[model samples]
Target: MSTKEFIKNQVEKFSSHITPEEFADLTEAENSLIILEVPSKDYTLTEIARIIESNNAHVMSLSVLPVSDGSTLLISIKLDISDLTPVLRSFERFNYNVIYYYMKEGEINDIQRERLQELLFYLNM
Candidate 1:
């Protein structure tokens, strides 16, 4: 089976056990989560870590789930940094198939926050 098919099958099974809110809560944690697929022959923990480190990030935890087809493995990684934009781009540049990723929503930008504060002061609410 192709990699996509295997990944799809696994995700389907996994989704049945968790609701969207539950899943969101899981991803909204301090650490970011990334799910990728790699050919069994090309899988290497060191290589993945090196790639993440290149973006000044570190992997908090990693789990490897072997597909039933035995051709590709799904790599689930939790990163210490919540901003996943840089890490996602780095993985794409390296040609890794990023199947899923979740980053906790960032707070309002400084300018936006300041504007809101000024408005609130005027309203005195």
Candidate 2:
């Protein structure tokens, strides 16, 4: 199945109350969101959030994925475009292996946005 279909299934399983349309709206509102994927072995979700918070960035959502090698934490944070530099520097200081992506305002595509919305909804609950 496609990623969107997978997410829809997961959402249905986790939060049947949230409709597709509502998820869309939630993602739309979070256009300024940044996603960070960090290996769980390097840092726990709380530690990562604390690190981000120390740099003045707010973690809006966090989730974990377990794999054969190890787990990975997926986090969504709200931050200004300009604050990216310092936050990244902090990550480096902490020696975290992180992969990240973000879109400019009005630039988010449907699938990407929906996935983030599903993640936020899933993690929140």
Candidate 3:
């Protein structure tokens, strides 16, 4: 399946327990954010954020999932298309293992965009 389709499926699957409105909110957050599953042993979320920020990217949110060996981090970052390469390279320079799967803001659909706007509105309220 295509990346968008995969993302949609993942969102739907993960949001099943929530109400429709909550699901929409979760989907919007997922769409607007780029998800990075970074293994924790290499770098902490703060270090990753600092590395990205130094390279001119902005991190919006961060979470961690504990695993057996280390941990996995879910990071949402904002970066211009042009800055993607440099930011990725910076991660490599630090020997950070960034998982291949990720979502980009531009990949989100219109419905997701509307949801994102709504979610942002609620956050600002």
Best by lDDT: 1
CA lDDT, candidate 1, residue 20? 31
Query: Residues 37-85, candidate 2, lDDT per residue (tens digit)?
Result: 5676665667777777787666554444443455655544544332355
Clashing pairs in 3: none
Query: Scored by CA lDDT, what does every candidate get?
Result: 0.73, 0.53, 0.52
Give one digit per residue, the lDDT tens place, for model 3 in 6-110. 445444554466643464455443322234556665546578778877866666444444434445544444333322555666777887655542444232355
Backbone clashes in model 2: 0
Instruction: After superposing candidate 3 on the true structure, give the runs of residues whose Cα lies further than 4 Å from its correct spot.
Output: 1-42, 69-83, 101-125
Q: Assess every candidate by TM-score.
A: 0.62, 0.45, 0.44
Ranking by TM-score: 1, 2, 3
Specify the highest-TM-score model's number: 1
lDDT for residue 48 in candidate 1, whole number 0-100: 93
Model 2 pairs in collision: none
What are the per-residue Cα lDDT tens digits for candidate 1 across 21-123? 3554665333567889899999989989999999988886676888778888999787767667878888889899999876654332555689989999999
Whichever of 1 and 2 has more lDDT, that candidate is: 1
Which should have the higher TM-score, number 1 or number 2?
A: 1
What TM-score does structure 3 among the candidates reach? Answer: 0.44
The RMSD (Cα, Å) of candidate 1 is 8.1
